[model samples]
Target: MKTYNKLLLLFIFLLFCEGLQAQSKPSWIWYPGDFEVWLGNKMQSRRTERGTFLPPFWKFDSHYVLIDFHKDFDLQEAEEAELYVEGQYNVKIDGKAIFGYPNRLSIPAGKHKVSLKVFSQDKVPAIFVKGKKVVSDSTWLVTYEDKEWIDQSGKASDQSGTTWLKAAQWNFDNAATPPSAYALPTVPQSPVKTEKLGKSLLVDFGRETFGFIRLHGLKGRGEVAIYYGESPEEALSIDHGETLDRLDVQFDQKKDTLTTLTKAFRYVNVQLAPGMTVDSVSMLYEYAPVKDRGSFHCSDEEINKIYDVAKYTFHLNTREFFIDGIKRDRWIWSGDAYQSFLMNYYLLYDSPTVTRTLLALRGKDPVTSHTNTIMDYTFYWFMGIQDYYLYTGDRSFVEQFYPRMKTLMDYCLSRTNKNGMLEGLAGDWVFIDWAEGLSKQGELSFEQLLFARSLETMATSAALINHQEDAVTYGEMAKKLKSAIMAKYWNKEKQALVHSSIDGKQTDNVTRYSNMFGIFFGYFNADQQQGVKKNVLLNDKVQKITTPYMRFYELEALCALGEQSYVLKEMKAYWGGMLKEGATSFWEEYDPSKKGAEHLSMYGRPFGKSLCHAWGASPLYLLGKYYLGIKPLSPAYETWEVVPELGGLKWMEGKVPTPAGEIELYCSTKEIRVKSPVGKGTLRFKSKSLPKVKGGGGLLNKGNGNYEITIIKGKDCVVKYN
Candidate 1:
């Protein structure tokens, strides 16, 4: 009898231990999107021009100052927990307040609620809870306001009006690491050489880098002024420099002082008063710790150099979010970020950055103005979502924000003209490209194409969230708009879609904007596709695209039409031109005709253009999707296709990141080798002779020298061809 009782007790204890082990891993959590908004405001406000604070012209928003977080757990046994918070906070259990900020507390078993209410003015309100069974994670709920109030009789009133969302988290898994202390990692770097003239010192960092400048052995009682520039001319012109800083320091001993803000520059012109003295100057090069998963190398050294510069340019622009540039306008623009999203999916495959940028761009919105106040940019936001879903297959993201998508679409729908088409209303910036003589008048065919695509995104999102009615409505709307685009803009004589319509008649203009998008969007039939290719795309008479922003789509259109060879040459000419001018990073705009100082000038201001822009890194996408020809046929890359097109290269090798794992490939003229960590892939290529498969089975021979072989997950496949 005694042995039996002891055995039963041991069994019960073992079961309890198993339950404790099953607890989810703890992570830092906060109100959804509150940290991102707070961080964005912090990042954007750091911009300065000639010692003058330069904030965005548009309204800058902040996160909620106060938040209440709570979670209910039914523990099998009693537990003890510790709390860490970013702001002044209070804790409660089962509606009973704890006396003070208790570092640790004990809770009894049997379904109870643990809550924390935090308030802050400058930083985001966040918390990290560590315990055995009750830990902080996304499972917890957070709200800006908890309306549970006590009546006169001390009875709680209805708390139905308060809204709660699952807590948001990133890589802040360590309890000691809070969102408020987030900063990009940095490394120490010395200047290439220094040139001193009287009280002025010109320091060159050799190449374009961004970070806080450090002053060593600084014992000064006067003012120290620093002017930063991407060009030597801009740095020397103190008054017109885009970014500068002035510091008033009074140090008793030799101590190192770091600048409060990070700036983009290759050269710094530092001037000091008589009393101010500095031994040397260095920099803390700040950067995100992202692994370069995708790579490209070919026989052409110029292409390789272009690829390297593009990668560096992308890394500089890819910080907290896909920013427009490192030098100026650090604000997130939807159109710029859309290209960044594509490039990131190909290179780093950093889904967290993608979602963060999307959510930050799509703020808690009544959809006041188009994203970045541009009509086409708003549509890019929607298209970004579609791409995010296709690449990540994160349905929860779509489900959580489906309502916001509907509201944004509704805003667009409400602004449409009486003829059921999007037209520029008052205060609407119909920015298609940054070209002279471009008109923002009447209804643009480009805007309608974007609108139709946005509707399709809404339809796809609605279906994912089980909003069947909304799905049907958006589907019908997309179909209708697409039909209208074909009927209204299709210029048979011009063999292209007209740029815009005035009053009610279509214009005679034939721009590449809508026509190029039509090719990728599949709006054009076989005949129309060929016609647009000849009339608009191939026609050099059309206004040439100046910015990489539009060049991304233009190149993509050409690649879709199997014009990879032509697109590669164009990329070489456009992106290569910037490289020849000693560009360490790709520029916001590169005009081959512009010479020396002319190349640096833009927007009517000297050195107005950004040296490193996210959109300038489109070759990452073009090379990955077109040349490597690896894309997901299904969401999350469950089933994908690899159709390697050399695009006029002797051989090309690269990796494409997927949700599950990476797909690796190496291709030459006579042999091809490919391997994937996940997904059922189809490897297709064109060869004049029969291709033999090794380490795999079954090759499908499509007529006319096209062949395909099935690639299963976790297997290496090689093919030999003539």
Candidate 2:
């Protein structure tokens, strides 16, 4: 009887071990390249393309120009004579031609080579001319030659040292003839009109020029087009057309040139015809680029180009067969938006960068020269550094910035009041501008809740690194603060968490932000979770729930509740909703009907708001680490824990590169597999349906160069291999 009992126990232990080995595969493979592009590709068929110059044009500092025409003539003739240029295969003047003049010449906007041929009845004389544009009564020309012309070597030359020439000298004896000079018809200037279109700012003007558009306190990317019309309404209607092929001017950074293209005009025409009165002409644009400093310089068209390249790389490498061919650096850029997107790509491909500029940024001044606060900038820096450390396991970086990180974390901790809560103005608050529940003053509860949650993340990160003492102190403080928050804000009778408390009594109002914080911070008990799930997820009063802009936080809260299936549903809906709504990237908010609405910002203009690459990227990383279950376990940085949570996903597979080594996991309907370097460690399998493992010795000894585990069952496994 005793022998039979022991054998039965051994069989039970073996079955448990097998169950623990059943790992779920990851839905997406994270690599060092841009993952957002991959996400975009999976949902869309076409990738965004890069900027390509049509020819005879030079790109410079986000602008393009033709350098040859102005270099050979003098001020008087160049200003008086009209130039007719075409981007064919070569250049011709007055039906006569010049050899070696590039037809489709592509050059950066700075100084470049211009080969000109002058043909006349007799030998033509060499001429030099000044380039100028006449605007109304004023002649707007390059006066300071030093600043106007950047030489081939990118050096500035003084205009005083240069000379101009006449059109007669260039071969035109009848310089005043009809074809010798070109004139642009003047369009009357009308009053400027401003309108709010969906979540965008539409600025209409009466005329167009090569002038600068200054955004006083704005940071975003959008299409800026010059449109013509007789009245404001007609102009707005024409500008808002879905299929209008309006002129687009793009600044090419690589060649330092500006390239402008129009549908069928020698130059972009903005004139009001005989039958038409000057109604309104303005630049209609959209702000959807990833939000970050320095990233604001690029226009929407330019950003779309970069986004396209990124998406292409992501789609090409999503399959397991192509994993080894991934190029990690193809998407790396110094720009904030590019860098943030690169970090997400790095998770899929285990690659590291030698540069630590992002790390230094976190420790330096957080204040932006613009209206954005220190916290707004610092949050991105911290997130970047944390992601770097999490993937690379580079202690050198952690050691270098640990003190500064602690300083920032300590400062956040210090902000807690006697009630263990802190309140501050929410930076980048435009994402929730449509919420009618917000008071004019501010949402105190939402502000405090975000701070508290940020602190908790910091504390938890510290604890993950084996800073037991520091973690304990921070964790304890977090718990205490959470307790105080519940006691002060939660209403047992109402079955809802109040928005805020003034002196003691709770306010009865419930907000999406407040409730999201409660679930996100784990302030709710099991019963409270049920109430929130019912009220927020299933209740008709909360029918709209929150806008797509807040989908990141919403999904995060759902994940916190271990509701993977529910979160997956929301992810699909949010992603599909944005794509169908004509989003080039994830938007700040969602509109189901495609209304020409603008996202509201506290600073007034929607362009002043951060759009694409803001805090939205946090969800991609979180989904990769938590829901996908490819998380690191040691601060020493050598090994990672392969715990798979299938989360309703079909067959999934991906690789996570860590400082220690690379670990690959794959799962299918029939079987699950985990591969890593040989090391001895215990594996824990977690599931409510699975029974606990009894005394059967947990560690697996390493023998071969590699370790492999296979199981055939459900998708829940925790392997603590060294």
Candidate 3:
């Protein structure tokens, strides 16, 4: 039955691809990771602080200035192909160079090799080739250094050193829009209301947003100052803010102009100079082109509202690459992006975006400082890739990037001390959370836990790629590390994994970081699980997690431990706390103790906190995976399960994306509905009585009032568990 299903799905997919191919044309392609790297630079370089150009302080890498792209094609008949190149490029056919910069070329019948050598310093070297049958796509191979040496006799040297990768391409099908001309889609948006406060027009856009401010009908020769804010207070404050723009307007006619950089703000304070006048302000709302593939709607209004705002927050942060936030430090942070990747699995399920973001974060590997200069963040990068593979079942992605993974893992392994533990060396940021007075000293238990998980990821990836010895090595290393962590960090009195060990001795400090992770990572046994939950997770004395970054794992651990009902209240109190504060989007951190504009402060500055941070969207994952309870048991959803938990909701329904299709589920007190387009699934639930399918068979009883039923693809199942 599975074989037949696979074959049928393949047939349907082929038909769909045929339809798409008929409409679409060839797109530009480049060296596999170069495009993403270049694009990351472009996006990150656009970040401005107080209208001054601000770039990343870390070592930012660049794309290859030179690249060679080539593809061999066999045509039964002669054909003409049009070519578009981004930089100073030379086209070649059959290894012989063609004339200067030809837009069109003729290919003779039979097998032939078409190639282009391009040099671009400012942008990625890319090309778009289109024809009736021959076109540019992933089948083409690209290399950064094409060291092909030919002697006088026209004999070439061994091309061993020249590494060729499958070319990467996105939705750049048009001839006019090459890869270098890529930009996010934008839509014009007007302010909800505007008030003239003396010289400045205080414009309210109603909610948190990211866009380029446009000045309409401008005829001035003075500067226009645009102050942005997530709240009205931030925009109103002129000198004290995170992002603001001052534009010099020299327009003579009644024309319109837009601010050069896109900023995050709902409120814009347009302060014009004395001579600058006669215009209203609007914005071009810039955003990614991702479509919503998964959804969640629950019985609770606040939960629904929280879910909506989380979704919007994630959408705002999902640009060229998943960024930390939009307003400040609009750069990719691995830890922030890891959460975004998980959220994306439930919301967008955009596999390309996942791969693109991963590539960008990985960058060009020379094993620089830990990802984002934070130790835990580097581990998150590996875990992110592993999760991507599990969610999408795209082994080729793992297989392609395993070398980089190995190199990164090697860098990590080399840093371990004599006791097989990691302590923050000079220049390495421990960065467990944003909590105050958190210890960066000593061999941290949280880092060890993440390192063990990262090793496990390496083991899994290595095994997938059939590297048996390396897999065993990584597996053993992970096993040993877990043991080491347990020996060093576990405290019987504390009844939890202590926060860190000070010089080989466990500290009395009991934090939720390692303990919460231990529960979900399956590192803790049953008794230990109960101990940690009681002593640390629920204990009032334990330091609380204020950042949404740590709250994500905290909540996930609770959900995994079957405490969703309790977690529901926590979610309401935490996320719902932000919603009640008139938040249009989720925030970087939310402390109930902080009142009014106090919520806007962080990092020693007002508005230093990002209002729509990517990590703030954990509910998307929690609701879709935990509440809807649709998750893959095998890679790519070949086998999956639905273990829906209402979590205090009377009824909750949602769609979860799988590799092949979606799992649609509706769960309530009396009835349950499930329909899936891919994979075989087991629907598990509990009731006081026996349950029967609407069509026929009774559910299988697993004792203790538990019931389950097998769910096959393309079958709409309705169960009455009365």
Candidate 4:
């Protein structure tokens, strides 16, 4: 009787724990990479120009139509697991088929193999199995094509061609919320003010935002039109507005209707038909749910405001993936996302979003064209992978996606000209920036620099995955290309890399693109770095980078070269120029020379410029990396450093995120405080006299009044220096 009572109590406790876990964590699993592809398609299709559907011109791919998932488990006792599937599926336990799609399966106490084959054409095939010990998760293996066949005896099978990868799963802990049903969260928002003009209502949401507009108590028999704009002037201009929506409603009684699509706008002009009435207007503000794990705040308020606005701009651009802008495109552009990936490391530190964006950009095999059909953008994709690994230190992602990387690199290799170098081809777009009359005619120095960087990334990634042979090959390729770039483009008279090589001869024109990148990419030697900095980056004679897209790198190059004070002033003058113009969010391009409504114009259209571009938010990176001066010297910050710069600030402080945790700091003229959640950090700073330390051991002098102290994890280090 006592044994029976004890057994009942133990069972109840175990059951309670299982219930707690199931409610807290999702148990769904799918073929790795399929969900991201399907989700990317859904998100990318959301763009619209005025009222017309706008889809990507690139060759977008789709998810696999079918998949097989399986796992083996050893049980100490009989158990029951509840199964939920996203599509039609068949279950087999230990090579025996179950009858009629059983929702619950009872497994005897022993080792057994459980498999499920699912099919779906419109969505990714997914499944969830919840039990105490047999929960479905990444531990399960999956494959899109099993490539197995049965012989006449019905027992013989050949699966030599089959390859199983760990099932992919992200935050889909709920069986009800499968990957297909995923959407950005939304909240209801009321407009700040509305003005009525002749049956037309003009509404202002007070700032740039993206959402579905809701029309309340709608009773109409004709058309209701909405014009969306980033500015009030844009909303009032009916025909020239970038985005609009039209709805036809016929209802005897009041009916509330929400717009089917989201639009990026601050102002809306609603034109209603005669007798059509809406009591009020509201919006459902749609946004991605990413935490601000990283933070920045300092002595300068204007700089702080720029940082805050930059964060908001980046947050707005960071939707399903790192989109180019909220106002237009709303698709993953590799160049834009590369800056976003860096900003994410310093702000959100959301690794899944990083991986998801990378996967979506890569898509499935058969590299039909360069990513987004642009040569530089293709190279950016490979560089993004390198940064991802550097920041996340996730080897599994590289291992799983290495083949795709190889194929993409092979596509680049296959397109090389007779000189074993790539140039502008018929289909390839050599888009370095949105600058006008930028030559893409001959071999551009910028393209070769990006190519060399991509090759170096491939070499590093190959070594990470133990593909040593490929690593050596890519390493040699990178070395050769670097030599060719210097030989073909470097002009000592210009003191910079020439813009292009026309028919194997270097052009005299020099641009900031390659020179700025070389500084940060470490492609230039000590002398070359200084020469380029003077002749190109800081030289007023050079063609200035007008767009924030290129400015992200240009400013980054300056920051990497310890020009934080100059970069800070430039960031203030450029990004601060936008703030002065009442920009609630950063623009795709900002030319301080342009005045008034001219800021709204681009590509020959009155409102052609995107008001919230991802690259425009680069100060989030600049401040954290340059001003804050904390970065990972090794992958995932296993080894890191802090060399804080005052950068003309009286005091400054911020926290930067890492894979293991956050690195926090506070700095001033006389004192500095530092703490990290993960290992072996060297804190280097300049001091006038011998510094004092607490929570840290002895400080070693590195000459010229510079000192170093070892920072241990979970302990705060304080230094008092004169």
TM-score to true structure, per model: 0.95, 0.45, 0.95, 0.95
Q: For this target, which candidate reaches the highest TM-score against the unseen true structure?
A: 4
lDDT of 4 by residue, 1-722 (tens): 99999999999999897666545444678887888888888889888998998999888888888888888887778889889998899998887889998998788889988888999999999999887677888989898876767768886254687888999998888878888888899999999999998878999999899999999999879999999999988999898999999998887899999999999999999999898888999999999999998888989899999999999999999998999999898998888998899999999999888888888998998999999899999999999999888888888999999999999999999999877789988788788998987878888889999999999999999999899999999999999999999999999888889999988898889999999999999999999999988889999988888999999899888887778889889988999999999999999999998999999999999999999889999999989988888998888899999999878888998999987788999999899999999968999999989999999856899999999999989999999996
lDDT agreement with native, every candidate: 0.88, 0.38, 0.88, 0.90
Give a tens-digit lDDT track for model 2, residues 79-163. 2222322222233332234556432322223333332332322111122321232111111111111223556866544345542
Look at candidate 3 and tell me the lDDT of residue 88: 97
lDDT (10s digit) by residue, model 1, range 1-722: 99999999999999888776556678889888777778877887877766678887655667888999899888778989888888899888987889988988688988998888999898989888888888899999998876978879785443777888899888888878789888899999999989996778899999888999998999868888999989888888877888888998888788899998889999999898887788999999999889888888777788888888889999999898889999988878888999999999889999888888887877776678877778898999999999999988999888877777888888899999887999888767788889889877888999999999999999989988888998999999999999998888898889899999888899988889999999999999899999989988999999889999999999999999999889889988999989889889988998898889988888989889998888999999999999989998878988889988887888888888987778998988888888998777899898898888886557998899998899978888999996
Residues 1-722 of candidate 3: C-alpha lDDT, one tens digit per residue? 99999999999998787567544469988887888888887888888878789988667788999898888887767989888888999887887889888999899989998888899999999998888657888888988876888868886443667788898888888889998888888999999999999998999999999989888898878887888998989999988878888877888788888877789999988887787785788999999999999999989998999899999999999998899898877998899989999999999999878888888888877987888788999999999988998898999888888998999888888888999888888779888899988887888889999999999999999999999999999999999999989988898887889888886788877788989999989999999999998998888789999999999999999899889999899999999999999989889899999999999999889878888899999999999989999888888888888999998899999999887777899999888999988877889889888777863134688999998888867888898885
Model 2: runs farther than 4 Å from truth? 1-371, 374-391, 406-420, 425-434, 439-445, 453-476, 494-496, 514-528, 537-540, 543-549, 582-584, 595-619, 636-649, 660-662, 677-722
Per-model RMSD to reference: 3.0, 23.0, 4.1, 3.6
Error of 4 at 608 (Å): 1.0
Off by over 4 Å in 1: 1-23, 149-162, 251-253
RMSD of 2: 23.0
In angstroms, the error of model 3 at 561 is 0.9
In terms of lDDT, the best-performing candidate is: 4
